[model samples]
Target: MSKEFEIAREFEVDATPEQVWDAVTSGTGGWLWPMEAPEPRVGGKGPFGSEVTAWEPPHRYTNRVEDVEGISEQTLNQLDYTIEPRDEGRRAWVRYVHSGIFVDDWDNQYDAAGRHTDFYLHTLRQYLTRFAGRPVTAFATFEGPEASSAAGAFTAVARALGLADDTAEGARVRAEGPEGKPLDAVVDYRDPYFIGLRTDDALIRFFGRGHWGHPVGVSVHDFAPGADAAADEAAWKGWLNGVFSQP
Candidate 1:
């Protein structure tokens, strides 16, 4: 039998409860790869056809998948979000929980899920603080090869992006992304596991999952209108493969 796994988080953001609601329910396609949403009320259809288990505007939302798609093993997945207003509605506190069953490869699945939660939540905070109400025009995910799991992988990635050694929060970075995508950005968030950059029209996130025995990953959230997501994805894929495949 598969055991239940739950990841919980409590954090505050500069956004109001309603805004947080949009970020959760309406979808954060900007930071997250897929831009999908559920209906405002209970029983609304989700993007992946999951049933909306609970819904309360700007407050609580929960969706459950009876059996996770694409996974051969049986697994029940549910994500719950609870929001509360703070500071006369100027800011808000969010309580998030992602619970599911790991029918196979429990350790690796749990680790990837947990790390994703941390970085995704951090990206949410960045969106709220820096780019609230700015719709995502394009989004892409970049992945390195299995060899990227080797030691010092992120160092090479970061250097290629033109970031300085020991680049801390608030540091300036000027780099060219896939297809010469200009990134005149600032380091908005930085940790051993992840680093986030905010350009005028995008939020770029780098995941140092290689340090945790996984390949490196990157997410690009473009706010510019008419941005080509498919092209960007292809470009980034090629670039990451090159970066990781080199001697």
Candidate 2:
């Protein structure tokens, strides 16, 4: 007989259950979790090659195991989430159950699941809090002839400056530029205000505008292998013009 493993966690979130539910159900929201992709409907496919067995909106959701690799025989695994009202706002409870197994060595899987659950819940909280008490009309703009190139270069600079990460929220491209580059680089635009980095041939700049506000600006400067200051300045200005003039 395979031993069963169960784990439960609770979290108190400032956002309402509805807000949390929307984030959980949306495809873009799935990025907040460990799943490569998560379809938030009953009978829908999810990470771990499982299927959603139950979905009750902001109240409850459940997943059933459908496939497992390296296991002698297929078994059942379950994940469930429930939300309830609390004094200040709402609380969430996540339950995971594993059944049917051979040799019973799932410690690593359990740990990974725990981490993913925490990440998902935290992302939901962030989304809700960010939009809370704020107008729904926040917007941004990239005003330049080479807006696309500028934006792409800006993102590269951001990565170099550590202002953004491959896994951070809003790190995903929201819009693409003319040349298949990411135009609107929407990340968690918060503290540190700006970033700067030096590429092989240029100095890249990235300015952070708060979420729902105007972006400061981005610039690129040229740098020769061992050119004088004046020569470097001229080269930088020329490169800037060339990059900014793309049609």
For candidate 1, lDDT tens digit of each residue in 200-220?
Answer: 988888888876688889888
Per-model TM against the reference: 0.88, 0.42
Per-residue lDDT of candidate 2, residues 54-170 (tens digit): 788777777767335546455466766676656545544433333333334466545544544554444345445544332212111122233323334444434433343543444
In model 1, the Cα lDDT at residue 25 comes to: 70
**Clashes in predicted model 2:** 1
The alpha-carbon deviation from the true structure for residue 86 of candidate 1, after best TM-score superposition, in angstroms, is 0.8
The TM-score measured for candidate 2 stands at 0.42
User: Which residue pairs clash in candidate 1?
Assistant: none
